[model samples]
Target: MDPEGARIQDDPDVKVMMAGSTLRKVKSRSWKKQRHFRLLEDGLTIWYKSRWAGRGHSTFSVTEVEAVREGHQSEVLLSIAEEFPADLCFTLVFHGRQGNLDLVADSPEEAQAWIRGVRKLIHKAQTMDEKERLDQWVWDWFQKADKNKDGKMNFKEVKKLLKMMNVDMNEEHALHLFTMADKSESDSLEIEQFVYFYKMLTQRDEVWKVFQDYSGDGEKLMLEELENFLRIEQHEGEQSGQHAKELIDRYEPSETAVKQGAMSLDGFQMYLCSQEGSIFNPEHQNLYQDMSQPLSHYFISSSHNTYLLEDQLRGQSSLEAYIQALKRGCRCVEVDCWDGSDGEPVVYHGHTLTSKILFKDVVSTVKEYAFKTSDFPVILSLENHCGVEQQTVMAQHLSQILGDTLLTTLLDGQVPQQLPSPQELKGKILLKAKKIGGLEQCLDETLTDEVSDDEEMADGDPESPCTEDPPAANKKHKKSKLSRELSDLVVYCKSVHFHGFEHARSHAKCYEMSSFSESKAKKLAKEAGTDFVQYNTRQMSRIYPSGLRTDSSNYNPQDMWNVGCQIVALNFQTAGLEMDLNDGLFRQNGCCGFVLKPEFMRDATSQFSPEKPEGHQGYKPLRLSIQVISGQQLPKVNQKEGSIVDPLVRVEIYGVPQDQAKEETSHINNNGFNPVWNETLNFVIHAPGLALVRFLVEDYDKASRNDFIGQFTLPFTCIQAGYRHIHLLSKDGTIIPPSSLFVNISISELTSGS
Candidate 1:
C-alpha cells in the first residue's frame, strides 16, 4: 500500500495531503520490503495497521496505494489496494467497517471484465418479454411510422410521422435528419440512414449495433425486407408455441374470478367488507364521509327516502309518530299548510283538512322533540297552500310557537308580520309571495270602506222607521268589496313590523304575470314599508326596479335592494337562477335565500347525491317555468300573385347580460309558438337581457328569399338592465328569423371618473 494513498484515504473528506519521508516511516516493513514490486508499478504509497491481528496472521496489511505519474513528479494515481494474493494483489472494493467487502474489481483484467458484464446485464434487462412494455411499445411504434399508406419514408414523411407522434421538431431540425446517417445527400436514404432513423424513433441505442450488423451493404432496406424483419422479430418467441403459451400464462388475469353486474345492497355490503381499500372509490369515500358526519342542519325535501324517518312518519299520522321519526334521525320536517276556517293555522294540502294532520300539532311536537334532544335541533318549514290571509295567521302562530327556529314559511302570496317576542325569528320567516299584486296588496291594504248612496228614501217610507238619515238603495259588489277590504287590511298590517317576502308561483303564473308592473308594485311596497319585493325569476326584469326612469322597463334586484329592500327572494325553477346558484351569484349579490317547492328541492338534491338513496319516490309540483320570447309567420316568397312562400323562419332570443345565454336559448326553443304562413305569431316570453333580435331565411335564393322581409326588436320598448323577456313579433314576415340565439349581456356600473 502507498503511504500517501493511505493518508489521503484516511481523511477522504479532507481537501489536501502533504507527502514526505516522515509519512513513509509510518508504513510497515513488509510494505517497504516490497519496494521493487511497487516500483514496477507507479504512484505507490503504503500504510500499516497494528491492532486486530489473527493467529499467525500479519498484523499489518496493505491499506492504500498511490501510483506515481510517468512524467509528472506531483501527479499520482491514488487508490485503495487490498491484497488478495489468491486472486489479485490489487483489488478495488467499496470501503466497509470489516475492511472493504463489496469487491468492485480483483485485477485490471477484472475491471475490463466488469464493463462487459454490465453491458450484458443491461441488454438482458431490456430483452423482449422481460423489459417494460414501454420499451417494446416504442420499437413497435417505429415499424408503423410510415403514414399516408406510403411504401417508403422520405425526410418529409419522417418529419410528418414524428409530428403525428407529438415529437417537437422544427422544419430546419427535421430537414437536417436527411444526412444524419446517409453520409451523402442523394435525395434517398441508405440502409444505415433508415436503421439510424429507426433507432432515433425508438429511442433505443442498444439495438443500433444489431441493426448495423444486419444491414447488408449498408444500403436502404427494401420495403418487403423491412416488413419481413419486423414480422420475424415480433414472432420470435411465438416460433415455439410452448414458450408462447408459457408467456401467455404468466400474464393472464388473476386466478380469482370477479363477478359482474348490478350489485344488491347485501352484495355491496359484503364487497365493502372484503375490500382492503375504501369501500367506495377514494373520491366517493371522502364525499360519503363528509355527508355522514353531523351537519349543523340537514335539509331534506318531503319526498326524500334515504332514511326510514319519512316512512315511519307515514306509518302513523300522529305528531308523536313524527317525533319518533325524528328521533330516528329526521332533522327537518315539512308540513304543507292551508288556511283553516277556525282562524287557526292548520296543516293540509288544500282547503280541506279532514284527513291530514294539523300544522299546530306538528309544530308543537317538533318543538318538544327538539327540546328533548339538545344536540339534535328540529326545524319546520310550512309549505302554505292557503289564501294570503290564512298564511298571515299561520305565520303569526308559527312565530309564537317555534320562534326563531322555524326554518322557512312557504306562502303563496303572503308576508308575515314581524314578531317582537322572538327577535331572532324576524329573518327566519320566509313569505313566498307569488306575485307583485299579492305582496303589494299585503303591504298596502288598510281595510277601508267606500260607500255611495244612489237614492234616498222619502221621510214617510218604511213607516218612518228610519232615523233622521234615510237608507239608500243597496247594490252589493262582492269582489270589489273584498278587494277594498283586503287593501285596508294591508295598510293595517304595514303599520306593524313585517320581516321580508318571497315569491313562490307555478311557472305558468309567473309567465302570465311576466308583464306585471314592477315599478307600480315597488312604489306600493315602499309606501307600505316592506323590506323587499320578491318574485319568481320569470319576473326578474319586470319586478326589478331601475336606476334611471328611462330604462325603468328593466327591473333589477340591485336597484330594488339598494332602495332599502334587504332581501330579494329568487325563484329557482328558471334556468337563469339555477346558473346563478352554481356561480355563487345568489350568495354574493343578495342577502335573500332561495324558495323552491318541496318537489323541486327533492329533485335537485336527488340528482346531485353521491349515492342514490333506497326506495326513492318522485314528487311533482307545477312550478317549472316555460316562456316564449318571439315568433313570426313566413310570407310566400316563391308565389307569383299571392303564392305563399313557405320559407322556414328562425327566431333568435337575447337575454340580459348577466343571464346564461344557453338557458335562454333552450327556453325560447321550448316555449316559442309554432307559426303559420299567414297568421300572426304570438308567444308569452321570459328571458334575461333580451336585447336586439332578428330573423332571417336559411337559403338566400331569389325565389325563396322574398318571404323574409322584416326584423323585429324585443319588448317594442327600451328595457331596464338585468333579465327581461317580452312578446316580440315580425309583422311583415319578410325577414327570415334566426333559429334562436340566446345572448348573455353584462353591463358594468359606470365608474365615477369613467
Candidate 2:
C-alpha cells in the first residue's frame, strides 16, 4: 500500500506539494517513468509514486539531498516542451547514494514548481527551532486522538495516538506504555504525561531489547556471555570485563550475585547512558595528550554564516542560530555586522535579503550559551560593515554582554611570540575582525557622534529597499576608521586578508590570523604542501568555503586538515557526508571541538603530506582479520508489522587513499535478532594512521535503496584489539547496548621486504 495515498486523507504532518502528475526517476537505472511526486509539508521527506503498474511508493529524506535544479534550465526545458522529449530531466544528487536522481518533468511548469518547492521547503525545515517543532508535533497528536473532547486520553485513545503516528505498536507494548504513563494508576493520561510517556517509552524499548538479547534463558545473562560482551561491545579487554562485573554487582545487589552471570534490566539503562555515552575510554589518555601546545595546534570546530538559519539569500538571521551552533560544540561563529536603522549595529548577510538581528542580541545569546558545552575560547568572526559610530556600539555590546568573559588583553600582556593555549583563555570570547590601526592611534580618533551618520541606514526588514549616498564626487571614499573601543577588543584574532603564503610569514606574531578562501587553501595545499604545513604550526590559519559556492556548501575538510589548518569552517545548517566525516573525526578526546594535530603535521621538522610521503618511518601495511559472530538483538526500522529489511553487517575501512578504502560484509538475511553468520573477513590496510573503521548495520532491499539501521566509527589506533562485543549506536550517536555484534579482530603489520 502507498503510504502517501494511505495517509493523504488524514492530512497529518506531511503535506503534499504536487501529487497528481509528476515524474520520478531513480538514480541506479536508465528507466524513466511517469510518476506522482509528493513534496512533504514539513520538508523532512518527499514521497513518490509511479503512475505505471510495476513501480511502488518510496520516500527520501531531505538531509540526504545534496543539490537541486540544473543550470537554470527551466526556460530551455519549457521552450522545448512541445517536442515531447524523453530525456527532459533535472538531477538531484544525494550523499553516499549510489546514483543521482534524474527527475523527469512532462512540462516546464512542473519542473520549475518542483525545483522551487523542494529547495524552499528544505530551507524552512533546516531553519526551524527543533524543540518547538517537537512540541508542536506532540500537541497535534494529542488533539487528533482525543475524540470525546476529554482533557486526558484513555487506553483506547492512547492506542489511537500510535496509529495516527503510523507506529506499529503491539497490544502488550501499548499496555506497557499506558501503565508507565499512568503514574497515579488512574488509567488516564494528560498532555504532560503523554509527552513524558513518549520519552520514556523509547528508552524502555531500547533497554528492554538489550536485556532480552543477552538473557539466554529469558533471564539474566551468564557470566561468560557478560565477559564476551564487555570484551567485544565495550572494546574493553580484561580490564573492562572486571569493571563491568563490578558495575553489575554494585547496581544489582541480587541474592544470586555469585551464582548468576549477569544483572537484570533495572541496571541496564544506567550502564548504557552512563558508561557507554562517552567518546573515549578512560585507559586511552594518549589521544588527549599534548594540550600544552598552543591552541593553534588543534583543529577547531567552526561554522560559516552562523547567523543565517536557512538560505544565504533570504533566511532569517536569529539569536537561535548562535544557540544551536554553540550547543553543538562549535567554537568559532561568524557574524556579519552592518549598520542598522537604530544607532546600534545589526548582524545579517549583507548584499542580500536575509533578515537582520540586533548585535546585542547575538552577543547575549553567545554569552549565555558559550562554554556551556565546552570551556574552550570562542572566536566571534565579525564581517564588519558598520560605520565608525555603529562599530563602537557593536563593540560596547560585546564587552557589556560578555563582561569579563570578553577577551580584551593578551594573555601574557607582552609582544607574544607564540599563540595562547586553549587552557590559558578558558571562558574567553575573542573578537576576530579586520584591524584598522594601532590601538593608540585608534583611541585618539574615536568619540565621533556621527561620521556622516551613514546617510540614513536601511530599514531592518529583509524586504526593505536599499538607499545610499552618492560616491564622494569620484574623489574616492575616505578610508573607514575603527575607534579604540572596537580595535582594542581585537588584540588577538585580528583577521588579515591573505595575499600569499610568503607574505603571511613576514608577520611572526601568532595573534595575527590569516583567512583563506576554500579555493585558495586547496590551491595552496596542492602547490605548497610542505611549506603550508610548516606555516600552520607557528601561526593561526583559518579556511572558509569560497563565496561563489553560495549555497553554503562545504569543501572537503580533509584537504585543509592535511595541511594543518586550525579552523576549517563548515555550514552548520547543511547536513551531508562532509558533516559525517567531521563528526567521526572529532568523536575522540571527549568531543571538546579541539583535535590535536597529527604528529607529522605538528612536527614542523618532518614535512608530511596527508597522502603518502617519502622518507617516512614506521610505514608498514596492516593485515586485519575480523570475525562476524552474531547480532544479539537488532531492532526493526520504523517498528512495522512486516519489515522488508534483510539485515547485513558492513565493515568499512576508510583510509586516505581513494582506492585502497574497502567495505566487506556478511550475507543479508532477516533473522537479525539471532543472526549467526560466523563470517570471517580480512583486509589489507594501506594507511593506518589516517584511517578509521566504521561498522554499519543496513537493511537490504531488493527493490530499492538499503535502509541504515545503526553504526559506529572510531580511529584505527584507538580500538582495543581482541574478541570484543561491538556495541551498536543509533544515527544520532546514542548507544543501544546489549544489541551488539560480537567480533574478534586481529591487527598485525606485515614485515617489510617480505
Clash counts per candidate, in order, are 56, 8
Choose the strongest candidate by lDDT: 2
lDDT of 2 by residue, 1-754 (tens): 1233334324332333544347755332344466677754334557777766575688776655645655322322333345435344665645331234666776666666666666755565445332333444565557657777676998887876665453445689779878988887888998788887876554545346556766677567566666666666555666766776776765553657434657666555444433232333444423465566787788889988898657677777766567667866789998878889978788887778888878887888889889877888899987777778898898788888898999887666566677788878888888887665433344455544322222112111112122122346213344446655786788778665454667757744577677777777888888887778888887778777766655766676767876789888887766554565566667676666777876766765656655555335545667877777666456567565445346788887765543145565655565555455668787876656666677788877778887777777776766655445566776545444335676657777766754
Question: Candidate 1 lDDT, tens digit per residue, 1-754?
Answer: 2233234334321211112111111122133221101110111122222233343222211222111111111101112223322222222221111122122233445433323332332333234231232223333334456444333467766665554333434567456665675556665554446656544443322223323333443332222333333234322233334432332234322222112112222222122122111111222211121122111111211111111112222322334344433433333344555556686655532322224555666666666555332232333322334555665565565557766554432233344221111122222322222222333343454534322221111101111111112124223332111123222222101111111233323222221222112454465444432222223222221221221222112233322322222123221111121112211221111111211211211221222110111112431111112122222222233323223222333444332222212222221111111221222222222222122233333213454333342333422112222112212222311112222211112233333453
Off by over 4 Å in 1: 1-300, 304-316, 320-358, 368-393, 407-754
> Can you give the TM-score per candidate against the true fold?
0.21, 0.62
**Residue 452 of model 2: what lDDT?**
28
Model 2: how far residue 281 lies from native, Å: 3.2
Q: What is the lDDT of residue 156 in candidate 2?
A: 80
Q: Top model by TM-score, which number?
A: 2
